[model samples]
Target: MNKTVNQKAWFLVLPVLILVGFSAVIPLMTVVNYSVQDTFGNNVFFWAGLDWFRDMLESERMWNALGRQLVFSGIILAIEVPLGIFVALNMPKKGFWASFCLVLMSLPLLIPWNVVGTIWQIFGRVDIGLLGYVLAKLGVNYNYTQNVIDAWATVIVMDVWHWTSLVALLAYAGLQSIPDAYYQAAKIDQASRWKVFRFIELPKMAGVLMIAILLRFMDSFMIYTEPFVVTGGGPGNATTFLSIDLVKMALGQFDLGPAAAFSLMYFLVILLISWVFYTVMTNLDKRDGV
Candidate 1:
C-alpha cells in the first residue's frame, strides 16, 4: 500500500537551511578561496595551491601553539570532569536549598567570557587586587605576567572556575533523572556507597558525562577570548594558543593566505579529535551496557 508522504515540513525548514548556507557555507567558501590564492594588493590574486598549508605544517610557531593548546585542553578535562562530578554528588537532592545551590552554580556560566577574563585580570594585580595583595603579604611570588608557571596556573584556575559549573549542572541533571527505586534497591541489598555508585550511578551518568567531556574539550581546544584578554598570549609566547597565532597571522601581520590555511587545519583538528572522543566514549558505553 502506497501512501502519500507529507512534504510540508520542508517548507518550515527552508528558512533555516537558507540561513545556514548564508551564514556558515558562504564564509567557509570565502576562507577556502583565500587559502588557495595569494593577493598582491590592487585586487590581484595569484594561485598559491597548497604552499600555505605546507608552510604552516613546517612552521615551528604553529607546532608550539598546538602543543600548548593540547596541554590546556587535557588539563581542563582532567580537572573539570572529576571536580564537577564530585560537586554534583554532594549537592542537595531537593527542596529550597537545591534551588539556591542551582542558582549559585549557574552564576559563573552567566558571566560573559571577556568580562570574566577582565575581572580576573584586575583581581590578580599584586598592588591592588585582593587575591594578589594577600598572596604578596604572605610572601608568595605569584605573578602571571612574569612567570610561566604562574601564568599557566592562573589560566587553568580561571577556566576551571568558569566552566566546571557547567559540567556539575549537567551531571546534576543526569542524577535527577535516576529513579529512587535504584537507591532503595541498593539499600535493601546493603550495598556499600562505592558499590552503589559503581553499579548504578556511574553507569547512569555516563551519557551526560560524555557530553560534558566533549563540550569542554571542544571549547577548551578553541578557547581564545578569556586567555587572550587575561594574558594577551604573553610571557614570551608561553600562553599563545592556535587561535592567538592565527589572529596574529591574519590581522596582525596580514598573512591572509597562510592564516586561512591555518584556520582550516585548526577546524579539521578539532573535528577529528571530537570524532575520536565520541567514538571511544560510545564504545565504552556499549561495553558497559549503558
Candidate 2:
C-alpha cells in the first residue's frame, strides 16, 4: 500500500513564499524595470532599450570601482584565511579558557557594522583616539580623511579586526569535528605536527574553510556600510568599492537608470563568482573524500 502524502502542509509554506515574493521577487522586478528604462520626475518613464547598460559598460568609474573591489576582497581573503586557520590551530580545545576564548572571538562578529565603523572612526582619530595619538607620537603621518593610503589602511585594518573572528569560529568548528582517533593514529605513526596538520586536519577542514572563504568573499565584495561610514568612500575614493560606487550613483547622484543597470550586473558577478567557488570546493571535497 502507498503511504499518503500531506498536501495540506503546502498551505503552510504558502505564507513564506508570499512573503518572499513581496520582499525579494517584487523588488527585483521593479529594479529590472528601472534598469532598462529612463524616468524623470512626475512618475514619467520612457523605454530606453539598453542605453543605460551600454553607458555603464563604457564608464571608467565603474571599471575603477570594480578593480578596487577585487583588490579589497583579495586582500581580505589573503589575510583572513591563513590568520583564521592559525588562530584555530592554537585555540584551546577544552576547558574554561577555551570557552572564554571562544566567547571573546565571537564578540566582534556580534557588533553591528555601523557601530564597528564608528568605533574604528573614533579609534583612528589623531587627537582623542588612542591609536591615532600613539601613531602621531611616533611621528607616523596618519590621516584617513586626508591621505589615500592611510584611508585604505584604516579600512582594511578595521575589516580585518571585525570579520576575522568569523573565519576563526568557522575554522574552529571544523577543527573540532576531527575525531581524536586521527590524532592518536598520527601519534602512533610518529607524525610531525606539520604532517599531521597537512595530511589529516587540513583535508578534514577543507569543506568548512571553503564555505568560510565563499562567505568572506561575498561579504567583502559587497561591503558598504562600514567602509562607507569609515571613509565615506573618500580620501579621493580610495576605499570606494563597487557597492559604495553604486550607492553614489543610485542615491548620491540620483542616476537611477545607470545605477539600476549597475546593480543587475553586480548581482550577476557575485552570483557567478559564488557559483565558481561552490563548484571548486565541491570538486575538492570529492577528491579528498572529505
Best by lDDT: 1
Please write out the lDDT profile of model 1 over residues 101-126, one tens digit for every residue.
99999999999999999988888889
Task: Give the per-residue lDDT digits (tens) of candidate 2, residues 1-290.
Answer: 99999999899999999999999999989999999999886889999999999999999999999999999999989999999999999999999989999999999999999999999999999998899889999999999889998998999999999999988999999999999999999999999999999999898788789989999999999999998998899978888999999999999999899999999999999999999889987886688665
The lDDT of each candidate is 0.94, 0.93
Q: If scored against the real structure, what TM-score would every candidate get?
A: 0.96, 0.95
